[model samples]
Target: MFESAGDVIKPKGDVNAPSGLQSVLDVEEAAEPVLPHFFPDEQNDSIPRLSRDTFLDILDGKYNEHYDNKLIIDCRFEYEYDGGHVDGAINYNDKELLASHLFNSPLEGRTLLLFHCEYSVHRAPLMARHIRAQDRTVNAECYPRLNYPEVYILEGGYSGFFAEHRQRCYPQAYVEMDAAEHVRTYLRFW
Candidate 1:
């Protein structure tokens, strides 16, 4: 169906649907960017996944020993983020904004990225991959080199992390995207 608009999110037969951002002035359906569990090795993915405990380590300054500079990215919608998230995470749901943030930051190794959505299943992984891919495109001359080489994703995502490490979260409340209150209170406006 996305044949004419560059097919950036081409699906291979029926097993998967590869999605990404390709802004061309609203000419077609804007599919959500979701990275499937079985992302092919061909896609530009060299990012690492971290467990909840390890994520806590990073937050507590145990992982980097000094905590230098780390960026926790919560790629959830505004309402879900306002509901509750990692204390310092910035709610940036757009891929382009994420790429801009990563690309502009100097390659100092101090700014580590911890990207996650409600499940780390689709949204978060896709955004991380997008930034890495953009890095590759611009860094082609400097092959095998990336602006922010080592970015990370939280395994089990915030849902699992919040349950085990409630103290670490700010406000410590979890809100699903399709919560009844949200649907009744806000979705009608959209």
Candidate 2:
């Protein structure tokens, strides 16, 4: 007498359910994507899945210390880089001419490459794939933002730098202004 439910019943021994309709929960879960086993766990539709802590370790020189020279590439536009970026990142934004500048940089096989963008958007992974396709055996990875050991998305791009590690990432600049002092300073200046 279950007249209200449309999909509460499972046909006996039936296993070939449509993937499009799998959201009903009763449908079988699809096998995971065929990415590498060590793929980062922090990924989403927007961000790639990467281990947060492992990302930090790499940024902090753990991988470089162990391996030879490594490369960290910033894939944001020129204007974005002009604003700010990770201390030593190399700028690789060539605008709409993606084909012209693609693979122009000679990445070292012995080096570990880390790719970052404002939010890792089209740039980070794009470069990663290009790098891999060039030499299938090259060692490479990507990070949209840098929070270390735990790679994180820059919630507000570079502005997020202060939000994530206000005290640590920017020790000298994130000065705390007292509420009264803040109001007085603003009012007095105006």
Candidate 3:
């Protein structure tokens, strides 16, 4: 199945073809980006899913009792937010803002932080790293290890989210995050 914006997320080749399609895949692989899965098959129900309809429903009060005042952070570009975003999500422009927000916001209570940006996987995780680092820097009321609040990466990123179920207004741009080593190679070559 195609991700919302027709960005192929699977192994690039056609999975449906009994004979796997092959192509030159060039996305830079990050180091240890996908952490070891502690729960193999088990689902973590704690991570919230914010689909278009569900987001709208929450905004319309259908799920207000369960969702009101929870934080939803959209990491998309400014134009994207101005064009449209889920009803209540506040925009955190880049990784820096993400870190600052995490450092400043109270982490003691029940709040959900949903991070989304154009369906690319790297930005959210980078932002997560910054957020986690903030926990260590501050004398967190919530223990950094024991009970840090939950932060979620929106499935499919922004393109996946929008393309999967909603109409996208802007042409989707592909932003790839390279591993540190690859970045070094660029610097060396140039």
Report the number of the highest-lDDT candidate: 1
What TM-score goes with each of the models? 0.68, 0.44, 0.49
Specify the highest-TM-score model's number.
1
Better of 1 and 2 by TM-score: 1
Question: Candidate 3 residues 1-190, lDDT tens each?
Answer: 5656657544667666653333324322222211112221344333333444444444455644542246667775565565556556687766766666555665554445566666635555556556656655663332333223445566566666555544432333333223353465335433
| lDDT tens readout by residue for model 1, 103-179 | 77654644567799998877898888897789779866555555555577888788988888877777789988788
User: Model 2 over residues 1-190: C-alpha lDDT tens digits?
Assistant: 5554654674545587555432444433332322121443454432334343454555576655444554556666554555455655567754334323333554333344456666554556665555444333321222221111121232233334434543333122322222353566435534
In candidate 1 the C-alpha lDDT for residue 109 amounts to: 46
Report the CA-based lDDT of candidate 1 relative to the real structure: 0.72
Residue pairs with backbone atoms closer than 3 Å in model 3 (clashes) = 4-163, 4-164, 118-158, 118-159, 119-157, 119-158, 119-159
Superior by TM-score: candidate 2 or candidate 3 = 3
lDDT of each: 0.72, 0.44, 0.51
Candidate 2's clash total is 11
